[model samples]
Target: MSAALPALTAPTGRRVRVLPGVYAPQHDTHLLLRALAREAIRPGADVIDLGTGSGLLAVAAARRGANVTAVDVARRAVLTARLNALIARRRVAVHRGDLAAPVPGRTYDLVISNPPYVPSPHGPPPRRGSARAWDAGPDGRAVVDRICEAAPSLLRAGGVLLMVHSGLCGTEKTLRRLAEHGLSATVSDVAHVPFGPVVLSRMSWLHGRDLLDRRADREELVVVRAEQR
Candidate 1:
């Protein structure tokens, strides 16, 4: 087990700028970073950041001497991540595509993601809006489930995946899915955080779905670590 790392206030300091409609670094981002910090990333290790919004995690991995590639579905997010990587003077390959589609037939030593997991009553996530960062399908597994299925192919033997998502999306389900895919997985870290604006907006819907209690003021965020053996 890895010791807990201190919370980071901002990823890549204050240099990274988030454009409109791009997801900014928040508690979930920081939590994932903390998990990443515990890993031993050798120099020149291949790392990929899925859903790299502002490119914070990609930049951080580059700073650690890893060859980083970042992917995002939104054009603005792709641009934002590229700009942030440039500003950080880090060599990050930023691509605009869905999940790992931009890098086919490629595997990484480390894969990281803080994908959309908020259960939204709004059907699927918006194609062109800020809500794409958090508004997953009604069960909040739209992207999470995809990641679980893609993770096995994304990782090389001995490669590790560090993913963070809201407990609302089903932590055990993530672990089970990863295991079903032949990876040894566990919840590496967890944090209790107050509902963000997106979740707060759908509090009533969440309660109706029994995903949350009426008195619940916070949600559990979990970092799942899975390794391809």
Candidate 2:
């Protein structure tokens, strides 16, 4: 018999297989952390990565000399993140819980996440593929809004928060929600990539509202940076 695969090891020292819809060590997570690392990340800064599916971003922050906490709702995700952290020889607290609830008695200097932000159809929820990773509930803002709502309490004054999601959820709504939560938010980046066919439904809604004047930017990923006020 042939030798077994390396079990989908973590990239950059953190790895986790089985993220429900996608394979482990998610790509967007790596990208998000890469962007954050490019900024001025302070040594020993406390950082938290919500929805840390594969521990990619959490490990990156730890490698950057920040004390990091990565949380996920799935038990598999939590265990995987912890294992990846160990393999990387980095210290990280991996918690199994939803959103910011797992973390208590602490605040972070940086909070980053790549949450489920895609709007799903009105019927029975998707049964597979990035569906678990992509579904953001109803209008796709459910989880995102919760994260924004909790950030002010979880972040230190002037702490930075970064998130990545698509434009279909109304980027302005995200910014407005951040402001409501006392965090100054702005669009930092947008990229064009295939959002998969499931997102086409959102296009119809946009088109109906005369929003079709703007191009179909499946790649229109938004990176919002918020500073706790």
Candidate 3:
């Protein structure tokens, strides 16, 4: 049997206030944090947290003395991140916009995200509602693909990216896409987590797409780390 994963903990250990409709720090969030913890974040290093959700990753980056910027398309998420940063006594430049849109022509030493990767039976991700936090179009590449396409441009030379998503979205495809974009990428970590409500609700569809096993109750989450040479 695989070892049990550690309990999910907040980045600051203090209470993080999340606004309604914002994505809360969960398995994927903590998994990404674990990956981020392994990287060497120098004081004043530039970092960007795309799809920052509740700004947990941004706060962690700021706490490490990095100059951190966070972006999210959801207004509630943007507000939640700003509030959390304030509560953490950390300075995070939070922006409200699509991934990487707000920071034109800007590159960072580290880019991180836990974007929407759950394959949705719905035709596309909903523009409004709580579902936006996890729902992506069928095949689950809507947002992840965009990030892969933009990562190389978003990173400074020798920079790194750490993104976490469910393996159902095609881990190999992500690595290949990054490689095609000239980044050396690999799966740095993996975790088998039981299907959450979102995935459980679409089990039949996932099975139809061969993305899930008929008898399996868990799904794999992978942290893809890619470096810009």
Superposed on all Cα atoms, model 3 deviates from the true structure by an RMSD in Å of 5.8
Give the alpha carbon lDDT tens digit for every residue of 136-204 in model 1: 999999999999999999999999999999999899999999999999999999999888888888888
Name the better of 2 and 3 by TM-score.
3
Clash tally for model 3: 0
Clashing pairs in 2: 10-14, 10-15, 21-130, 191-219, 192-219, 193-219
List RMSD in Å for every model shown: 6.0, 3.7, 5.8
Superposition error at 146 for model 2 (Å): 0.5
**Ten contiguous residues with the weakest lDDT in model 1:** 1-10
TM-scores, all candidates, are 0.94, 0.82, 0.94
- Clash count (model 2, backbone only): 6
Worst 10 residues of 3 by lDDT: 1-10
Ordered from best to worst TM-score, the candidate numbers read: 3, 1, 2
For residues 1-229, what per-residue lDDT tens digits would candidate 3 score against the true structure?
1123122247546567777678888888878989998999999999999999889999999999999999999998898888878878999999999998998999999999999999988889989888888998998999999999999999999999999999899999999999999999999999988779888887888999998878777889999999998
- Candidate 2, residue 46: lDDT: 94
Instruction: Name the runs in model 1 displaced over 4 angstroms.
Output: 1-12
Checking candidate 1 for backbone clashes, the offending pairs are none
Global local distance difference test of model 3: 0.89
lDDT of 2 by residue, 87-116 (tens): 678899999887778768689999999988
